[model samples]
Target chain A: MNLTAEEKGILQGAQGKGMQLALSTLVRYGEAFAADRMVEIHSAHLAGSFGAFIYRTYYDAIRLMVKEGLKVKVPATLNPRPLEKIKFLDRIMISQQGFLEASLAKLGVTPNYSCVCYDRENIPPQGAMLAWAESSAVQFANSVLGARTNRNSVTIDLCSAVTGKTPRFGYLLDQNRRGQVLVKVKAKKIDFPALGFLLGKKVVNRVPVLEHLECTRDDLKNMGAAMAASGAVALFHIEGVTPEAPTMKDIFDREPDEIITITEEELASLRSFEKSKPEMVVFGCPHLTMSEVKTLGEFYRGKQVKLPTYFCMIPRVRQELGGTDLLRDLEAAGVRVTAQCPLAAWTIRALGRKTILTNSGKLYYYLHKSEYGATEDCLKFSGVSS
Target chain B: MKELQGRGIISGQATGKALVTSQPLNLTSGLSKPWNLFNRLAAVYYDRHHELYKKDLYNRVLVFPQTIGSTFTGMVILETIRRGRAPLAMVVQQADTLLTSGLILAEVWLHKKVPLIEVPDPQLFNLIKTNDLVEVNGDTGAIRIIG
Candidate 1:
């Protein structure tokens, strides 16, 4: 791959050893993808802060870089960390969280611990290039917002954060962004998350254009997250819905590479389990938006939760909803508002196992096998007898 | 011995018994249950294939279609390698940037090399079988099937 004189200088340690290492790693990574050159990235959202405790090597690497006086050159934000004041955390987990927070501070990353950083912290313009790592966030940026980003890995995202550039290949380029599959949605009552799960399974690694589906931005967000979870799809265009494709013709070139039709039965079949008694109910997998939080608050206000219900949100969103009656109502209903990812938090081993009921297709897909029992949709557990 | 050509994502060499899967592997969740908690010994495969559910991935050549699910694939691969429970090498039908990034970080941080090569040919999957002694040269993108 061709590099600019400045890139060459950085590789040669003209900038610093930390930069040389970072550039070298990125150059190797780019070569693996056959990227011709580097593209300047508008922003970066890293995935390192959350799970750094499980993998000490990641924490050590960041600490070393910080000790070398290296900091991110571009605007960057971190994924969610464990809630600092949570009572359930053990001593070891607490220390690990503190260690990660300090390391991130040294690296100059904004403490905006959100998987949905695109929602508020860094909303890139349509077609703007980015280096974001979280799968759901990557899907949201690419499919819903029309910004361009690959499903970048965690370490590679950090490299891009330091350099403000990423390999100019894959989803970053225009030719690779066209829809290859046509998915006709025949389901009248569109379960956005289930549709996304089914669509992802149908079109693995190929971009799909949805037909006859009208969806809101929040619906698209849930759909994109499920799709990315169930399949390797980084981007999808909804006909006349998403920003990129205003019409069917706008998404496909001459003809769609393939076509698949999804029926109501097919979407229904995507649900993993029918009914089960739930020990816990989880709401947010990609972190809840402000609207979602409000809606949940209203729904569960007077009703008492039969089980331990956890509503996960980013710190920013939680802060925005602070001092409102909605927050008070949620707290009164025995709902614990958290800033940490439930998926990552469960890795603590000490958290133990419980039958979890979640509305998130992404969460259900990942945890169904491991947990005692994971059922789709919290409504299934809502009216169940305790 | 039959040689198959592929694109090398991570450069290295290894010879090991092969573990082939027809389905895509979700490196994050498929490897084990949540209760395992990064313990390679207790790690159990949670895919549809029940035969390989409890099989060990350590020092074996893992051949699969592609990686599915989670951007945390890189981190999972890194942790598996860190625990010395990773496959000796990997051969995929297509290049996966998420998986490759983990191998790259493992190479850099752990000073360990696990060759990863992608064979785009559909027939290659049919040609290789389980427990075949395969020699992988990631630098040259060659897989020698030694029977």
Candidate 2:
């Protein structure tokens, strides 16, 4: 594999232990993908939600490596969820704070617990190599910000942090990024949540050119989150939308491999709605923004929901709602704003899941597996109006 | 007993009695219930509703496959280490760098070294059971049950 002089220097032990590990992994990963050279990245967003399996090793590895003279130079970022959101008096977030804190201290990295790092600050340059994993973040960086990144793992991200480069393959390769699948939505101006549910269920890992998706940049954000939650989609081309796919032809890359049609029937049939009395309502699996929250609040508008509904929001977004009549209105309407997501918190145990209703496709999908009562009839009965 | 031995990276290793689980743990999705904690050993995203496997205090090491969960899982490892409840070594079905990274960091922070290994084959599941004593070598990717 070809590497720039700086990267080579780092590998040669000029940069330090952290950088050495970083560069070595980047080169290895690049070689694995058959890439020729490494590309520079501005920001590094670490995986937000990993299990104890990851925590047990990453902290120790960084501490040891950093002692060998490696450091993360560029500003690093992290996924949205903290390890343990509530430590009560401890004031700890993120998994494994003790180990992670020491590891970060050793490497001199600060925590920025935000998913949309590019949105928050310092967007990477177009074609920049990003070592991010979240499907939504990957789509935003590649499609919206025009920053290039493969669906990298936690190890790969750390490697990039040290080496300051990534393998030039996968989404980074121009030829590999073109759309292979064509998906057309017949519904007029699809709802963000429903559209995401329909597409996520239909599209697994393939790159598809989405047609008839009347979405702005913001809607695309929601769509990407939904897609990430349901499937392993790394990139998507929205026809007549997105910067990369300026025209329908561009979406095909060089040529179309296959085209698949998504109809309203298939979309509706994805969810199994067995009729039952509604016991609990849940929202926010991929997470909801202020705009979606507002729309949901307005839909309920003094209408007391028979089932207890917990609307999950990010801390910042939740803070934004503070002191606003939105909070008062929501509470009065029986919509409680939760800092932790329903999936994250077991509010259902307190509320009891006799039947659960949700507008989010992701949340709806998890309800059954989590062993909640089915309330498909209630969701349909609520209609598009609600 | 047929023994396959190789030097391997040990994660969540312990010197106590062995509690081995051949079932693969899925950390991608959330787990709920009294069994959620034990069933989804890798997942640390959900609230601590289940206390089944709260800490690795058991002298025996808990064995399983690759971990799947939210990114901050390193914290869970740290807690286990701090409470002196962590396993002495860990044996995974695959070489999951993410999971390994967390366990290694926890071990380092606690200033202890544990034996860890990625199993030689996915089919090693057929040869192992809970509470079986085995030596793991991550370097050579080997597993040998104590006879």
Candidate 3:
């Protein structure tokens, strides 16, 4: 990998054990993606699920690391979940109390109710390297910030932070970030969530180039959220939308690999709403933002989701709602103001092996194609259980 | 098969189950409580009820792109590890998640250390199986399933 002498020295443990572990992890991650070397990340973002597993595994690590005197130096922020509360509530649930909490104390991670971590912290220099994990963050960083990062997992984000490098792969490579398949939109201004649902359903397990629509950073953020919720698109290439698409010719890292068009009718079929009474209207597969909830609340006033609906917004965002009495209004209207994500709490409760209603394509696809094959629809409705 | 091998990471030599996944996991929403509980309550649920979760039935090898989700997942994994209920070792496609945190903690705090192989090869899938004795080489990003 392209490493400066100082970086090489750090990799060789001249920096310290923490830096050594971090560098080693980065080197390995880069090699896995077939990248030869590392790149420096201007900023870092901490990630955690709002469930029990995080307490069990990572919580313990942070505790031990803190006890050992490890710390993060670069300016870093957190994803939009409340880790402290989960730690406090579940502390007694496990036999080892101080084990995980101490580690978190050491890491100094914040529960800064924000999804746009780089924007929130105002970190990541223009065209800088990054190691963010959240899909929307990845999309925004690569497409908006002109910053470089391969779509990474939670584990490697730290590695990049510690080592100050990431493998040059996926979105980091100029050749890899280009638009592969072309996607056309028929709607005048494609609704953000529906656009994501349509894109995900059409490009299940594959990459495609998006076209025929005007989108802003906000619109793309919404698209990223919906795409992650409805399908498995960790990264997406939008023509004239993402940073890579400054021009049509530049849309493809190579010549246009392929193209696909989307229509309103095709978008409609993706919803799959059932005819019978709906069971639930679930939101926040990628986890809802306060702005989204507030927007929805305006339409949903005095009306229940017309079915049982669960919404899991970011904990920090939930805190904002608490001050505004939004939670009270939401709950009084019969909606659960969930601070934690349901998908993150897969170990807490079962959604049953039954068909569920949701506007999220990512959740629908995951549940529908899950082991039990629970049926799902975009339109509000019910179906016979298997 | 051109094989690569290293010591097991999370569970020690578990045999009889195999599931390989290289898809990256986002912890914030992908893994949750009841699912972790489900993983504990119903072993068979891995296959029929929770395919999104890598099943460890029949044989005992679980491969992932990497461990994702929360740090607390390490504890649940440790609980399963203490009970001998988890897979033999975790072959992570990458090396960044709480998987390493859990392994380090089990080794240090809990005094239970399991091998966690960080192999980054996208092609490691070709050489592993549900019933084969596999070694994970985190150093080289490869896996060798012993016949």
Q: Give chain A TM for each model in order.
A: 0.92, 0.80, 0.77
TM-score of each: 0.93, 0.66, 0.68
Best by DockQ: 1
* Error at A108, model 1, angstroms: 1.5
Per residue, candidate 3 scores C-alpha lDDT tens digits across B118-144 of 555667666564456665543344466
lDDT of each: 0.79, 0.57, 0.53
Compute DockQ for each candidate against the true complex: 0.66, 0.10, 0.14
lDDT of 1 at B140: 94
Over A1-386, each residue of candidate 2 has an lDDT whose tens digit, in order, gives 87778778978878665666557656754553467987777767666333332344455456667668666766667554432345442222234655565565455454544455555443777777677755566767887776777666555566666656667777877886788888767754365655665565456556778774566665777666666555545678787677778888766746666667766665556444444444556665545667767866776666665656777665567778989888888877777776554553443233343555665555554445332222243333343133
C-alpha lDDT of candidate 3 relative to the true structure:
0.53
lDDT by residue (A265-334, candidate 1, tens digit) is 8777755444555577877887888888876677777667777888889788889878988888888878
Model 2: CA > 4 A from native? A49-54, A65-71, A82-112, A122-126, A189-202, A253-255, A273-278, A300-305, A346-356, A364-385, B1-27, B30-147
| Highest-scoring model, TM-score | 1
